[model samples]
Target: MKKLLHFLFHSEVPDINERYRKVTSAFVVIFIIGYSIGFLQLLHLGPYLGPGLGDNVSFQPLITSLQALHSQNPSLWYALIALLCVTVSFRLLVMLAGYFLFEREEGSAYPIKWIIVFFLCNLFSTLTIPLLLFALATLFWVSGLDFNLGWQWIDHNVRLANQLVVNHVPTLINAPAPIAVLMIAIISGFFHYWFHRLGHTQRILWLLFHRPHHMTPALMQSTTMAVFTALPLFFFIILPYNLIFGACTKLFSSEPLYTEVIIFNCLILIPEIFGHHTALYQIASRNQLIRLASFISGGGVYHYMHHSSEPEHCGRSGAVNLVNIGGGPLFIWDIVFGTYCPLSAKTPRAGLSGQPELHMNPIRLTLAGLAQICNELYRNPSWREKWRIVIGSSSYTPTLSTDFAIKSNKIRQEQATPNPATIKNFTFSAPADAIASVAAKPVTGPQS
Candidate 1:
């Protein structure tokens, strides 16, 4: 176990030249896994097991119409694929633009290899892992265990709320599909803001999951996805929003919420991609207008500022200033909560303060982060902690400190400088006894 921890936490940094190959391999592996999951979903090989698993009875007409459209016109599939391709291509182009336009110092600029690695890391952490977890949760549900752990109670309440709205509220039930979709998006975004905020302020969550992203020495476009966290924690991080979305869908509309979700996600991605940009691009004439847009959409310079390693931007524990700018698609939450940091504030240093120059490789870094969480759990035996871990509690004691960094720096500086004080304090003693004094006396005759 010790050896494993050492391997996970103490792996040597890879050479710059080798990083590209390593990163590419990681991407390929995650892509294959993600693709397989998607393929299974499309084939309906996996049972759709959840609260709303077979609740499409009210949307049979819409489902039939979609099925008929698919049966009549195969070209629609091709068109949809083309549209997805175009959207992805545009996002990639924007990332490239940010990379080139940003003026990064030679030392600080991310190498092509590192950028690829970071991008793939983010992809796996954000998309692939969450998808896998959702699938697993569904599988668990099919086996008759409510795999939701901490979320089951919340899910039950949400379902009840949905039932009330759908069966009781005639106006909401009759609302237009677009309005329903918009409401879902806004509600989901609001929850996401809180989830992110809680992740930072909560000690155990931050140490196990959130700290890795902040540990990076520099920020690049790919840094947006570089969340180093336990896989289980990743599942918990995303579960609330998914549950809330499902509830809203069941409550508000008969149409399949999947399409709406895709659209909302794509729209949200626009700001997210730009927010991760290294260069600041002024989007409007007035700063207030820009802030307002960011507040509404949950993107822009404020998000970038959240990544700042400076104490002011982030708390002493390295969490982003929760009092300001921790929203998702809406910054209004931050404003209301009094955590709204403006973009006009001076750009703060990015990454963890006093971060080590030499760090573990990406894969090891991830494993190490998880290992730390397990170790913490083992040390503290409490049902509450276990429940929190299972249900994704966003509270814990803050433990990360600058003491190690300060001590390491002090040692390095001491090693670099000779201890003149010690040398100056050195003194030679002579025996006071006549025989010892004669032996210790200087040989004056010989010197002469």
Candidate 2:
């Protein structure tokens, strides 16, 4: 048990615990800040009523006015504030914080700085979200007239997904929380994995959207990091189902059930952060039972395989279908289709062939920061860039050529081994204590 705990919390690498601690602290701080912001908006105070000891039925105009003053839905104000904070101030704060907390030197974590970069990129990305919502609204207005302009198509799909999650799946499974979570994990995981892979397999998708995600080989602590590039891939394909399914979930489920869904979403996002980030962490399966659970639950090292660079690691071309390639949290469809990769005790890149450079140097990084600001300022919107939806159908076959596969493999490999030397040379920041600590106490490196 002690050994197990050591691997999970410590590993051979020094400061792993410290890094996790910092991240947790950051999350706590952010959550508290968010709550404070929410509180200041005074949206929590709803219609209040007081009962008199004898005449409880008596209503007073003054009391009503006071209650109205105390209680108002600040949804619009909250949204506006979130827009300003997340889009504008968040990045600036992160940059300043990163520089303050992290070092700019070699082998140090510029996590703080990276956090800023992620937020700014994400803030810029949010601009498209409002546009997406408006486009959908306009399409809905047009579809009301029976004029088909591709808006109703998503609405139709959302309805279908709504039926699947709210009605069909519920009836099929008796258990609510566990079953709902598992089912969602499976279905949504499949969609996430496939859609994510699809974004890589198809070059057009890669060029149009995904490259931005890969553009930064690592991740930072910013809501923008979560929302920005993720929005493109998420909404571009899954928004219809997501929006409709969410509505159906709320409509069909009671408060308790809704709470379960929220909990499950949080659980999923934690692993998601781990999977998407450049940080390589693994949940080593202890025994066969645990391994079996990992394949179904997908909390194991399976996702790291998708990020693998070796020819053997991801050589199956036709297997590019997301549903078939199961990544941790249960999507039984992958197993039924024989695509599930069992949990391994080893780290993801262990024994895998190929290396890729994913990180950028200070100069390029600075340029990226500048370009992000510029694009936010003056980038033009086009019809294709606007209101784009990705649906898999008989009409559109997402093409995946062999050369494309090779190139993707190479990119993943390169991303694994960013030129830290180059990055450090151009970097003018202090070195991270985590890296310094690790360097001071050198342990045997992972058997890559």
Query: 1-448, model 2: which lDDT tens digit per residue?
Result: 9987445322221223344657755754674356333322221110010010111112242234234433564553354334434423433443334333433322456444444444455555656555665676677676684433344544544555544444443333435665654543444454455554555554335434554444433323332133223443445554443533343333323222422332333333333323332333332223333233334345433444444433233333222222224432553444443444333233333211243332322222222322322332344244332222132221122222111112234212112222323222221212232123222322234211
Clashes found in each candidate (C-alpha, N, C closer than 3 A): 8, 20
Q: What RMSD does each model have against the real structure?
A: 19.6, 17.7
User: Distance from true position, residue 45, model 1, in Å?
Assistant: 21
lDDT of 1 by residue, 64-128 (tens): 44465468676764554454455455456655555444444222445554555455455555554
Report, for every candidate in turn, its global Cα lDDT versus the true structure.
0.46, 0.36
Clashes of 1: 8
The candidate scoring highest on TM-score is 1
Q: TM-score per candidate, in order?
A: 0.57, 0.43
